[model samples]
Target: FVFADVIGQIVELTPIEVVSANGKETHKLTVELRNEKDERLPMVLWGNFATDVSDAIQGRGENAIICVLRFGKIKVWKYERSVLNAYNVSDVELNPLTPEVEAFASLLSSVYIVMCTIAAIESDMGCYYLSCKVCSKKVLNVPNDNIDEQGDEDEMGFHYYCVKCKVKNPRLMPRYKLHLVVLDNPGNSKFLLFDAIAMQILNRPCNELTGSNFEEMQDPEDILLALKDLV
Candidate 1:
């Protein structure tokens, strides 16, 4: 799709994450932009754009302002449409005093960002889940599947299937999904930290703590130790 501008309130902001794409490590952050009409669209900010937005949210502690994206491109994955910034060509602005923002200023309200402390590990629910390396979606093993030409089954069980991507023997990765109780000003509340936030808090990715083999469950000792250290 053609590059265009998108302005909305930033909501559901994820921590800045470093991921490997095309053999290069890059920073990325995912966020939802909510318009005045309450329509929300998912958008991903990569490289400097990711760090810039994360820094703004950290410094402001509120997400109620308008975000301006210039030259952002639309991306579709599995029939879901989202926005992504065009490399080197896109620009990002948080709370710019533009005419467009001033026109819709009255319709927007600041959303408070909450700060919580980790109280304790809620359960032994494990630390991560197996997901497709391509799309980061959960995948299932295909039974009686033929081995790839590389004969991966002997090394690591092969033939996992992604229902969404519709691929066989797809590469896999481990993603964090921790169950914990967090304490904030109000009270203790249960919080489930998925891969993005969990990696940010843990200072490491799930792959660092576990293996990619779906049939073999990795020892959660490292993950548990990290969680205990946080408490």
Candidate 2:
């Protein structure tokens, strides 16, 4: 088996197209690869290897580590072998735990805890806001509308407001785009953002905070510090 280290975010997935040539059907897959150094290479998955393309692309987001088997034939155009075959994509790992990964994970975990604590406090105060630490924006909730862009009825929908940015933003932002900033007890700081549902879950209204006026709200930092001590 031809083995090579390949890592990249899945940029595109071509629809499976079959062509008949010389009384035989041929299947091919075109995949784009970008390495850590940001080099781009086009790989072709052919025949039996092409069958595994769907599973390999499933849930594999951008900037993921992927291993590929490379096979190709010499071509004059590039003064190198033209990639003719590829596949057996396995050992797929996301955001590999390198030094950078470890640092990021620690920062994210810390930020997540802080945000959760804030949300818990706010939930007690009967207020909900999606906080973006990177932009320092607070997302506000809007009444659910039963219509979509096409004027079609969209009963299962809601909207949000960003008080800081002064723009209507999507309720669901991509995970990669959101990050957390962490402030450790030792004065170290970092940033992080949770997926939408996680954010809501962390802030789910509780009896202590729910139905309470904002003026009666307590400091989130105090709650966070207490929770931290417990941990």
Candidate 3:
């Protein structure tokens, strides 16, 4: 009964107020969708039938393809309907090509640079710490005071905590200088913005690539020139 380009990921699924044909106020089960371009669209379900359909698509994560009926116009371009109004579900697939999907994935992998002095490296055990451009604080082993309080001293040592900020400091404290540069294939001249994680990886304090040390290279033809400068 309804047909329009479905957009957005399912953000919330619940009941919302609707105005019927006779101008009477009614409640209908609805699903909210945010399209690839970040537009919001709502689908509504009417009567008791909305229950089963609502349950089916309720908790579906973002980027799901759904089908719903177009009952009545809510505004100039938007329509009001519910899951019960849905007679069918289309692809129901999550596409990786979407901007939202790509952004989210990149964000998860991107390193968070804290205060030009510390970079939080993502690791299996949690975030591994590294030194910053302007400081000498290394990710060091420390006593887990919290676990120590529970009499678990054996689990202590080698924990990834900043020696400069101290364990008691707030997590938002900036401890490292971070920058990124995107490498296209080898021998290519173009470079892109460096992500936070890439900056952290580059900040590993190699003998030749130490903090701002790359700046000393006199000739543009030097090997260090290949190091993408992402500022």
How many clashes (backbone N, Cα, C below 3 Å) per candidate? 1, 14, 26
How high is each candidate's TM-score? 0.50, 0.31, 0.25
- Which lDDT values do the candidates have, in the order given? 0.74, 0.40, 0.38
Error of 1 at 182 (Å): 17
Predicted candidate 2 versus true structure: per-residue lDDT over 69-153, tens digit per residue: 3334323355533344433443333456566545434433121124322212222332233433344333444555545454222
Q: Write the per-residue lDDT of candidate 1 for residues 51-113, one digit (tens) a residue.
A: 778767756753365789999998878988789998899999988988898877678654546
Better candidate by lDDT, 1 or 3 = 1
Return the lDDT, model 2, position 72.
41
**Residue lDDT tens for model 3, 63-118:** 34434333333333444443224334432333336665555444332232323322
Best by lDDT: 1
Lowest summed-lDDT stretch of 10 residues in model 1? 211-220
Candidates in descending lDDT order: 1, 2, 3
Alpha-carbon RMSD of each model: 10.9, 16.6, 18.6
